[model samples]
Target: MDDVKQNVQKVPKRKGLSNKGQENFWGYVFIMPNLIGFTVFTLFGIVFSLIMAFTNWNLMKGLDKVQFVGLDNFRSMIGDAYLSASLRNNLILLIVVPITLFLAAILAVVMNRNVYWKSGARALYFLPYITNTVAVSTVWQALLHQTKGPINSLIARIFNLPMKQTPGWLSSSKWVLPALIIILIWQALGYDILMYSSALQSIPADYFEAAEIDGANAIQRFFYITVPLLSPMTFLLMILGVIGSLQMWSFVQLVTKGGPGTASYTIGLYIYRSGFQTYRTGYACALSWLLCAFILVLTLIQWNGQKRFSID
Candidate 1:
């Protein structure tokens, strides 16, 4: 009887293993196309770039003509004054993200307060984010033109400021990054508004009702109830904002081209220049790796801070 029981258990265990294997095989088969593409495109390129970072190569030089310079590319990046300035611009991007989010949240709250045409307000806000980046940059470039732009005209009227043709926005050293920030904020405000509005919708109505019954003022409810519940969404926005800032390049490319002596330059623009403009492919790879490392470190810090704060 004991032998018979052991045999029964063995048969069932073997059948279970066979079934599990078959399921896993099907799963692998289903995802194999994606896996193969990812490995070929992303993984291979990453590995290739890693290898290239240690060498020096250009179009003029053939592949085998590459020279191994170990950490020299890294050393070059440290000493490169342009790169330092670009990093500052990148940091400015980080600053813009949260400010944009805050503005969006305020706008969203007001719009979503059951005001008429709430959907229209939402659409208007999101429109800028979905607009063509190049077109927006061009429009901004025109608006910030020194002589005839609306912004300078407004400034002249409000503050009685001496216009003095206000320097060409993208050309001016002091204002290029700031100008870019303004455009970025304008472009992204809508997306953040939509996200915060969605989050507000997801929040249960009970909290607000109870607060209303307690004779809570709008300010009190916003602080004690809305803010606490919205923390996680804000936290997510923070991370994405930082990442977007770190990867920022399009507007710079469209407007400044890292011009006026690299004032409004960023790491993404730097990498693009090294690879495409300068034809220093290997050096570009090194620059990319450094950028990747910088982003990784900063992102890790932000992520850790979020977890510690228990934003979720």
Candidate 2:
């Protein structure tokens, strides 16, 4: 009995997973649900949409009616006046990215200094970014009213102009895009400022100190040292900003409904209108693919340019 007991004790317990293996197993187990969800919802949706781009699969007509039309959807794009207008509007909105970047950098520099209520100021700037888009859109709509809005009212009083002389804003096609641009700039400022402020923290103080010691004024120091140091962040923000601007449709849909005769139309808004409003799901998918292609090309150009210009 003693010998048997010794043998039993000497026997290694049935080999199981090593500690690292067990940890990895549990890690994968914990992430499995999210992984599955992403595969099914995101990946599958992308594939499905790509396939649908070549078919006339209107939801109203049912999946059985999904007729493959080859490149008919794409071919139709050349004659799409609405799509052309949306593309033009999208190109125009590209200006928002640079303008927002410039303003955000300035504001970030100011916020970085020892200003009063610094934390409060940062929060105030970021508030609009986190606020509900619908609420912001609604408020802006009221504020940008042609004659009755407070903005026009203030302009009339300050400039000594009549209400009729004030810009039509959302009502007039001539001014509608500009009005949208202004609203977008205001709404975008908060996020950009937050990004710039965070990037500012990572920059070493040595550069600024050296600049000041070299007899550089505030403006010169800002232009030479601060801006150069922030180039990487600026590049990242530019890409994100451009993508966001291209994908922007919620504000257009909610505030102007791409109204004033398509002045505020965007590719994204047109896609939504095509898919849901008109049940042209196939056509919408084609347009979406086009937008995707444009973005991809633009992003590639930016990446290559950065690689060429960036320091080794």
Candidate 3:
């Protein structure tokens, strides 16, 4: 009777194992399409681009004409004056990321409080984020026109100065970058506010109630409880903001076109012009890899620092 009982238990165990195996097979089947697509489209392209970075192959040349000129492209980047200018422009724009994030956080905090038409207010703030980039750029272009733009007109009237004396925001090399930064900050503010609002909402109300009970004022509660708990989201936004700022191109392209003598040239614009405009595919690939490395290093730095402030 005991032997028969043991045999019955072994049969159920074998059946359970078979069921688990079948489930695993089906799970793999379900994900196979996405896996294949990613490998073909993204992974293959990245590997090919990395290989191209070491070669001297313009698009006009056949694959058979590709020559291995290892490190030459990389060395050229060191002395490339345009590359230096692009890096400088990107670094200047990096200031916008932090400022926008800070302002967004404040807006989120204010919006989180009980207010009339809060939903509508939030939507209004986020409108710029969803609006078409070209349309937004064009509107701003009109608004920032050197002579006829409303912004310049307002400034000229306020200061009692000639319209010509008013700053040439989009036209002047000195002012173009700052103008771009302002527009970018305005455009990005809505999304950042939304992200921060979501993060704020996720915090438990009980935490705030508890802090209040312990004699903490609103300001104290915000800095001590809210900020700490929001650190994870803050860190995430910082990383993403840095990455996005580094790759910023469209605004510069549509607004300034890296113009007034390439003063607004960013790495992204440089890479695009090199590959598509100049047909220097190899050099463009090299520039792209350098950008990838720069982003990777910065991301790793932020990741490492997260442990100090992130909740988990």
Candidate 4:
């Protein structure tokens, strides 16, 4: 009886150990796909780019035994005139991003007030955001046409203003960047408004009710109750907005092609021009790595800031 009892106790312990091992094995199996992909794709890509950034490659000659040039590419771009223009454009977009988000928040507040026609309103606002960029940009091209355009004609009607000429948006350097920003903000506003609106909805109604009873007006409730709770979303939006603005290339291309003396050029477009257009792969990669570092810093800062605020 003693021998049998000892074997029985050992059997249960052995089964428990076996079960735990199986559970861990399955967990590893499930995560293997993503782990493999990250290593193969993202990690490998970063490593390849990091290596590429140190050399000079051209389209005529491949990376065949390329000589490593340390920091020349980085040094070259630092004082480049076109780079300054692109940096200026990026800065303008960064400044405009917060303003755009604020506008979106205000729009969300008003829209969230009444849910009677919510679906229609959402579709109306989000339509531009979902629309094809090329098509919308083409439409914008027509709208901004200087001579014999609807916008000019409309201006002629309102205030009976003498419409000498509508601004040639893509054609003129002065209006190109601002025109690009206008369209970008228009496209971005709706999505951000809806994001904020959803975040607002997630906030507890009791807070609003309490504020209501305390004689706090809508604006006061908005500033105190809503904004604070929505900080996480605001932080999220700003981070993404900054990233998107920094890499803003499509609208810059469709609208201006970095023309009008490259006034509307951006880092992304600049990189593209360097690599494919100018066949400076190494220099392009250098630019890319620098921009990547900038994005990394911004993302880290936002994440750390969120942690601080939440903890505080």
Candidate 5:
């Protein structure tokens, strides 16, 4: 009887271990497809590109004729005028980020309150974010047309300005970057608002109630309680906005095509033009690696600084 009881316990122990192993096996099986795809597509491509960045591999000459050029490709970018112009344009567009965040936070706060048609308002704000970028760009292109666009028409009507004075938004070099920044802000606003709204909802209502009990006014409570707690979300959005803004190219490409004289050219467009249009594959790879480094450094800085302001 004692031997049989020990044998039974041993059997269950083995069965439990077997069952746990099976569970792990199925888990891996379920994730294998994604793991394989990520390895083959993303990881391999990144490694290959990094390698190419150090080699002079003109596509016309084929991979067999590739030569290791050390840092020659990187050195060439030191005085590249287009690169400088692109960097400057990117810096200019960075302004859109803070303005958009501020506006989105305000809208989110308003939307979170008890209001009629709140669901509809939320949907309306988020619609732009979900819309296809190409379609959005195309629509904006028509709306920003120099001759017949509604934006200029509105300006003319409101300010009683002449057609010439209304400004050529997409056509002129001076206004193209600003116009693109506006469209970008409009497109990005919806997502930021949604995020802020969610973050606001997550904050405990008792915090606000306590502030109110202390005789804090609405604006005071908002600034002290709401903004401080929302700092984490703001930090997240700031990082994302910075990264996206730095690599902004699609809207510029679709709208200005690097402008009247490369005035609105961004680093991303510069890289694309270098790689495909100009067939400077090696140089483009180097540029991409440099961009990657820049993003990484910026991200690390933000991460390190999060402790200063992040409530959580």
Candidate 6:
């Protein structure tokens, strides 16, 4: 009876599946749901949009009414005044990437040193990035008010100038883009700083020590050793910043709605207006493809250029 019980306990292995094969099979099983979801939603949507770009399809009209109009939507883009203005604005906004990265680099250097309330300072800076976009825009809207806003009020008091002489931030086309740029920079600074600070920690102290022993000043050490080492992070932030700036629409939509004669219109805002407001689905799809192409080209350029500057 004991021998029979022991033999029964020795179960046979599977006929074909090895341990690794079993693991891979189970892994695929676990991921099957997500894979299906991506296929049904993301992948399908992408392919569908690409096809729709070549056809005149109005949402209001039935699917059977989709008219084939190859290249017409693409051609229409050349004469689109709104698209031109929005693209120009997006190009202008690209300046935010470099400026924000520069400031973040400087601040990261300062914070990496012995500083007061370091954790609190970092949290305060990061707060804006994690905050709700609508809420942030709302707060900025009030702060940037032409007359009653604290910013203009402070300027008026500091310069002892009348309110009329103070710059109209959101209200005037001349200052709207600049105001938006300032807000973008402030919002993005914290994330960049965090990334920089983390990168700074990884750098060996020996590098700085050697530089110090060699009689190198703070700025010289920063430029020579620090800058080169941090080049990879800089490249990463530059790519992300440029992409974010180009796709920026929420702030413009919430604050100015591309008003003051499309002074602050961005490609994203134009796309939204075309698709939702005007219901020009085909044209919107075409425009989005163009934007995608632009981003891809720019990213490729940056990727190729990074070899020249990146340390690793």
Highest TM-score: give the candidate number: 6
TM value for model 3: 0.88
Off by over 4 Å in 3: 1-25, 213-215, 310-312
**Runs of candidate 1 exceeding 4 Å displacement:** 1-25, 160-162, 165-168
* Tens-digit per-residue lDDT, 189-223, candidate 3: 99999999999999988998998999999899888
For each candidate, the alpha-carbon lDDT, in order, equals 0.84, 0.90, 0.89, 0.83, 0.87, 0.89
Distance (Å) between predicted and true CA of 185, model 5?
A: 0.9
Q: Once superposed on the true structure, which residue ranges of model 5 sit more than 4 Å away at CA?
A: 1-28
* Candidate 1 RMSD computed on C-alpha atoms after optimal superposition onto the true structure: 4.7
List, residue by residue over 1-312, the lDDT tens digit for candidate 1: 999866755664444456557668779999999999999989998998999999987756688899888988888887789889988878876879888978987787778676897888788878989999888988998899876888888877787877884555777888887788888899999988888999999988898999999999988988888877888899889888888788887678888888788888888888888887788878889988888888789889988987887744
After superposition on all C-alphas, the RMSD of every candidate to the true structure, in Å, is 4.7, 5.2, 4.3, 4.8, 3.9, 4.7
Q: Give the per-residue lDDT of model 4 (tens digit) for 220-269.
A: 99888888888989999999999988887777778778888977889888
Model 4, residue 81: what's the lDDT? 84
- Spell out the clash pairs found in candidate 4: none
Clashing pairs in 6: none
Global lDDT of model 1: 0.84
TM-score of each: 0.88, 0.91, 0.88, 0.85, 0.89, 0.92
Model 5 lDDT per residue over 264-311, tens place: 999999888888888788889999988888789888988888876564
What TM value does model 6 have? 0.92
Give one digit per residue, the lDDT tens place, for model 2 in 200-281: 9998888889888999999998988789888899999999999988998877999899988888899999999999989999
lDDT, candidate 5, equals: 0.87
Q: Which ten residues in a row have the lowest lDDT in candidate 4?
A: 11-20
* TM-score winner between candidates 1 and 5: 5
